[model samples]
Target: MRRSVPMQRLDGLVDPRQGLGAAEAQARSARYGLNVIIPGVRSGWRTTLADTLRDPMLWFLLATGALFMLIGSYTEALIMLLALVPLFGMDAYLHRRTQASVEGLSGRLATTARVLRDGSQRTVPAETLVPGDLVLVRSGEFFPADGLIVAGEELQVDESTLTGEAWPVRKQVVEQGLFSHIRETAVEDVYWGMAGTRQLTGHAWLRVTLTGAETLYGEVVRSAVAGPHAQTPLQRSVAHLVKVLIVAAIVFCLALAWLRYHQGHGLVDALLSALTLAIAALPEEFPVVLTFFLGVGVYRLARRRALVRRSLVVESIGRVSCVCSDKTGTLTEGRLRLTHLLPMSNISEQRLQTLAAAASQADSGDPLDEAVLSNCPPPVEQHILARFPFTEDRRKATMVSEQEDGLLVAVKGAPEVVLGLCELPEAERRDWLAAVEAYSNDGHKVIGCAYRTLTSEAWTGANQIGG
Candidate 1:
């Protein structure tokens, strides 16, 4: 016999409910805290100029230019100065463009959810969300705050934006680890940054465990900002080539200066000749050429709908030996649709309509259920029975009501569960199982719906029923 794991529960959590006074909402907002904006420091013109002058390559070029000017080599000095202008300008333009992009991103505001507080739900900006606030999350809604699962059944959330994991993670109120246990599961609310997750079926409430810059997604963005941008292969190779050229130029210049001096050339003439040689040996136009190549790459990548954060990163992409990608969004469309429906028995058209109507009414707005109910005819509202909410564990929803002939029961869930509950012919069962396996192998999700008739005396709660 197998032993069951006991469910864990904690305290100090509140359920989300509608109805809050204006004052209460304000108080909640105040208690949670406000969004803080940090400004970037501006660089002064003098500072920028000093930084440009401090570059080793720039210093070398300047020294060469000065030596040429001292020896009356005006043409070479002017050429070297002209080369410096474009390199400096390109560097300035790239820096300004990057700053503008970051600034624009900071200015855009993300939407916040209206969550229940002290009996009333109030809409607030996402930035205003604070830890310990109760939030309400629903199907087709984004999570505004990061919180612990307090009270929920079958809550599945898509964390691809933050975790980069394609599959939706199933969440429960109970803590699963140290990070999860930090918040009280009873009063956690889901926030908007995680809004891409859709409710498949079932209701849940979350308490705000983290907010603002402390949220998991916020941390991810922060880390990305701090992490070094990947360098492209071209950028790496170009950098290496530049270093080698500089070293070769210096060695060649020293050798020529010694040779010219020994050949009875005057100090001034020999120094000027060495400087001219250095300038010629160094590819002063390399920086300008590399900048143009990077610009072309950036334009091409942008046209393909790929944003290159750094120009150098483009070269890195060219050097990648292997690529890893998630199948859900990268390979296939993330949305799952109902492609086919199978009714268990050869029921009348009217009976089919009734079952569909009942399922629609208690669907909790899941996409799959909505699709099934879309073509359903008008249902007899009065004949509807108490709804049994769908849960991942049970994998089914059962509807039952007293009928004039007997008791009518309808069940819907994963095919395996429905098939096991229904007494179908062996051949038919094998065929249906085969169909389900085929769909699964083809990457199409499949579900089953079944209906049956029984005596009122046989009715029992879902816990007592084996199916």
Candidate 2:
């Protein structure tokens, strides 16, 4: 029979407990060093020899050098060995440096969480968090421990780091207290670090459900650390060239040995001469040259705000023919700004202010709404009859309110949507459409606004005007 685990309450802050003193927490964190495996000591001679032999370039060079040695060509063998050793060393150094950098990054991350324990709140290193330990999460904080949200209000989380989403996601405690319908067997309500999310607003307590490598951040770290190193295009081309050269050397040696033997020379001496020729043909300095090229390319790309994940991708960028780009954030600022105001009928600044104020107050905190409110003057004192939030699908916001003279209505949304609802002159509408099209083709996102007056008797929800 399976034993049932009790659901832990995730509320309030955990106090520091005796077992988890500051000294212990610091020591634990130090030991984990941001929860990453530190690079161990370098391998000794035997391991180093094994690694060198395993390298493709080193293997090619070794085969060539062995052939030279067999052919009794000491000078060529020495030259090949000298060239191969430095290349092997460069490769080892680069690999170790990359590994060390990743380890250092991992060490900078938080490894534990402060949680409520034993009816008193206490700081617990994430490794010590039990399956049901209550952990507190605050705004502007990274979730060091993974758990289900048990209590929270008005919480917005920026999960873009983990999910690549550009907007904040609102989180709430589900009525069931646990998200059972989610496909993952793990706690459903608990967020993972792979989603790259962080709390934006409000505070809540979570019961520690997963820790260490099992957490979302752990997965991200694993992926980042385990990602394959990209090889440069030149390196690949050189490797291919080396393979062909090795085959050619083998053929040339065989042919030379046959010719020398036919000309009455000893088979052994002929074989030795053939081996020397093979070693001389091998280009062991190619790797060092390739490394220098890759390093230079990476530095140049970094200056352009592009991080070269794979050294080879730098070369690929040069070969790209056509580019498909996103309009938002890539080309434009992505934030809407007020540019112009067009009144349908001639009105004084005071009347325009009255209309702009009513429209601005009805805005629903969007970029366009913020722009409109910024351009409009504040209302003096007025009550709203009805207000509707702007919806991207509807592309409009409508508000009905009472004015000093009579009832008035204001509307704002995408220019095309407002224009379709307006009864403007045909010629003027065509000109406006042409201007809008021109702006759109020039990559400007446009919005339109309209207003109408209403009599008390005819003031109905459906009668609100728009343009």
Candidate 3:
């Protein structure tokens, strides 16, 4: 891959303001091919049949049958040909079923992408995207293609699927001359996003550099296709053993042929007799015996509440040493419950609960808020005076409630944001911040809550302060 160039240099190659025109895009799409990843050649009856013909055992059988036919041994040739009927049928059926199942699944993951075409923004199929296209990505949307970040704001991406990085990466737009030297900026920071990664926050416009099977994620898929087929150690051993047996049978046949020729028999007759001996040398029921034992093992495992997906795995069951899994929803129940309550003031826990409940939205779609409201009773005779809905920019929610005593303004949000709005003393403020850090470090999601007493004048001006 070429090193990332400066945006100014890139601007000369493709228009950053208008992007590629429709005519040029169509021409390039035809040249570059569709933006689709072909992990492996699609399996079909023809490929399955070809693969069956490539097997070593099948080759041995075919050679033996040919020699028999050449010597006019009609009955032996027919028997050898008939032996392959069941094997070929089984191989073709399995391959066709697996291929159809994979093709059906690929349909569910196809996505629509937003791109700039003909100097206008439009949504199109992700596979239609080409190089040099300007693509827009937003929160909750997966990246359409691999590209460089031309412009962005607070853009954070979850690359867990690609890099196994659990935390979201914050992406920033590079200014002019940032890549002038090429050695200053990191490659990852220069490139915008990759396909299959999700945009977790903010928005960005990327100049598509690679698409289709050439993309990073596409390369991963391609590598899987180019990789060796999965096989158990036992299966590999059995295959090797079969090859050895076939070679030994061929050697014994040649020796028998030599002895018959010395006994004054014709060359054709000697070869025919050797071929018959080779046919008897192989165990025709080997596959059936192995299949029967594996099937019985699978049944036994099923009776013990263990589901085995493939019979080949039965032989490798004793090799399992360790199992790893994600902690969320696997090691834990993953259900939220009210665990602890912290009140910064001298107020009792009951007072805090009532205050939080009064400020909480009854139908709030947040699980934490739901847990809080469920543990507290509604405030008596309290009416909502003003409300400020939560937004990405604010990172907080505010509510003004009017009670018999006075009007109260409640704030609940990120610990840092809420702490900034509170009027606590310096010493008390440090304590609150320390508590917040402690909870955060313990892997607990903390929501800071604070309130202030508001007079009539303040309540009237609530709208100005975004209450």
Candidate 4:
């Protein structure tokens, strides 16, 4: 069962028929703040400069430079100090450029949504959305915040970004009124849409329940910010080496100072000699060499149209052996076509496509659904009786259609999930599983589909299919 917190909160605050007044919307916006996901801010140039100066090698160099001046070697001291200027300047430049690039990308991805304010539909920046605001969600838009669906038509959302399941969940009206009006709700009479999920199909009026940091996406963003960052093996190794070098530098400095003092040198002169000795022993050129190699790698990647932001990432990128990418938009073109259909049963390819099409939402704006509908013949004089939309837990959606002969229940989803719902012979199931795996290995997006016909006994009494 789903909690009706969204409905309860929005009940009196927002008017389902009209929406929030202009003055009230402004007040709530001020109270709730912006509905934006604050990204992890990287360290700035000043912080980077401080970190570089604090390095054991840099510390040794600075100490050595001071010793040269103390011993009256003014030229040597000046040269040593000048050597650090270029290194610090280059590092600071890189940090500032990366920061600016990230800011530009973030600005481009910022979205606006159609909202009802003062009973007029208008578009506003998503960050301005607050609780009690009415948002008009349509196909192919990301939900701005968590909200209750006041009104919708065959609404289906793909929450794979949040739940990691590649299926669309249906949202409808709830029977028991969560709000005094707008009764139809979600799965098990709980009507709610989450932030960051894409609306695959349908148009709906959503009354904002939770906004900004109070929403689920906001919670995730906060959790990530609070969590400790995972260190790579290279980073850990480098850190350990730094600690070892710092300890070694201290010991060497102490030993050299004692030896110089025993040889009849003054205390200040002995300390200066020890400092110079320690700095000479340090690998001063190691950082420069590493940065040079990383810069080269970045240039090579840029030639191939890849942007490398951080120099430290070059080593990590080299260690990557495999690259996994999303199929629909990332690797392949946005357009998809159903080229082949392999059915386990005696059903022909045409029949299988027809059944799958019947279950798919034609205008859902989902690529897979659109592909299925495009390949299969258009439905004629068909009456959709009932539908059980897909959920993350169930992983499959079912549709009951009234045909000329009788009622047919169509099911389609991810291969393993849809297979679990049907009863199949062991040998046949094994062969079917093998086929799916074979297709998957060939880089095909395989979808499993199955159907069952009722003889006025099963679906008639139930009048609904449990998803």
How high is the CA lDDT of each candidate model?
0.59, 0.58, 0.68, 0.70
Best by lDDT: 4
Going through the candidates in order, what is the number of backbone clashes in each?
25, 13, 0, 5
Give one digit per residue, the lDDT tens place, for model 2 in 221-330. Answer: 67765666555566688988877877887898789989998898998778777766666666656754664565566668767866454455667787789999765556
- Tens-place lDDT per residue, model 3, 1-467, is 23343333234444345587888889878978777844445666778788777655566567767767776778878877776675575556546545554454344233788888887899989888888788888766778877777787766676655565444566666454553344423465435677877776567787777778877777776554344445678667777777778789889999999999999998987888787887677554454455456656766876785544445567888677887967644565444566778985588888778777766776443445567788985675778888764545676677788866788887777777888776668898899889988988997778777777878765665433322
lDDT of 1 by residue, 1-467 (tens): 11111112212333333234447446655865653221352455665566456555566567667766876779978977776775466456545655565565354324666666556667777666655556666655666655555566667665555444544456666444532444432322332223334444445565555555555555554564456654456656766887898899889888888899999997877787877787667765666576566667766876886655556676677778999987765776555555655555566655665665554543354545655666663255335455674666777777675667776676767889888987778998999999899988987778676677667677664533333
Model 3 spans with C-alpha error above 4 angstroms: 1-16, 38-43, 57-110, 165-167, 179-186, 230-240, 254-276, 283-467
The whole-model C-alpha lDDT of candidate 2 against the native structure comes to: 0.58
lDDT of 4 at 89: 57
TM-score of each: 0.60, 0.52, 0.63, 0.57
| All models, RMSD in angstroms | 8.5, 10.3, 7.4, 9.1
Residue range with the least summed lDDT across 10 consecutive positions in model 3: 1-10
Q: Tens digits of per-residue lDDT for model 4 on 1-467?
A: 45336444455754455688779888877876777755545686668887566545456557657867776779878876776665565566556655665554344222787888887989999888888888888887888878777787777777765555555677875333546654334334237777877788678778787777777666765664444434547656765775677679879889989998999998988888877776666554554455456667766776775655555666888999999877654555546678878865578888898889888876666767888888884387778888665555566667788887888888888878877767778787788889999988987788888887775456664424432
User: Roughly what TM-score does model 4 have, to 2 decimal places?
Assistant: 0.57
TM for candidate 1 is 0.60
Model 3: clashing residue pairs? none
Better of 2 and 3 by TM-score: 3
